[model samples]
Target: MTAAEVDAYLAGLPQDQRDALEDLRKRLKSRLPDHIECLSYAMPGFRQPGPKGKMVVGYAAFARHLGLYPHSGSVIPLIDCAPFKTSKSGVLFTPAHPLPDALLDAILRLRQDEIAAGYGRRG
Candidate 1:
């Protein structure tokens, strides 16, 4: 999605939650400038664009919880190495929840690996 679209969506959220999600979005962009691609999926998703197309990594929002959608084979294993809680296919963290920095870093690294492996092409 365009920056404007992202802005509008964020604006529609409740104040505190909007602030938190916006903060998360800003931090993700700053941390993974090269690997990050922002677009609207079920919500705003940060993905690794592949030759076959984009592969989603994760998405954060005010409604429920942040969802880490690790598309590569190694991501789930990496997140499992961490102390954070997760479900079958994604890591779920609530709005009141603190962002799992270590897990996020690992996820970013895994995306980098996918890119280096040529599994990700620029989108």
Candidate 2:
């Protein structure tokens, strides 16, 4: 997938969701300067650097909320995502209430660690 595809995904979203996710995309870019952007499972995400890089995180816009997916079920349980709806692998938020920087950072760090530890990647 290409950055244009990711932009298309954002462009197709509702304005509120677009704005929220655009902010998220920027923040994620700033935090993950070395990570490559890509699309996975129809969502915009970043991948680790390698011939076969692993997806580190993903974000999507839903009818009711936005989501930050760490691409790992275990990562969600390891963080404190109070005030946001969360499932086994995704953290749900809204444009009105987006994921805080600290939370996003924590999620990325944990997922990066998991990738470094040889987890959540294709063998």
Predicted candidate 1 versus true structure: per-residue lDDT over 20-87, tens digit per residue: 77777777777766544556455665654443445546565635655566555555655564445675
CA RMSD for every model? 4.0, 1.2
Clash count for candidate 2 is: 0
- Residue pairs that clash (backbone atoms under 3 angstroms), model 2: none
Candidate 1, after superposition: displacement of residue 36 in Å? Answer: 6.0
Model 1 alpha-carbon miss at residue 23, Å: 1.4
The TM-score values for the models, in the order shown, are 0.69, 0.96
Candidate 2 residue lDDT tens string, 41-71:
9999999877788999999998898999999
| Candidate 1 lDDT score relative to the true structure | 0.63
Candidate 1 lDDT for residue 60:
52
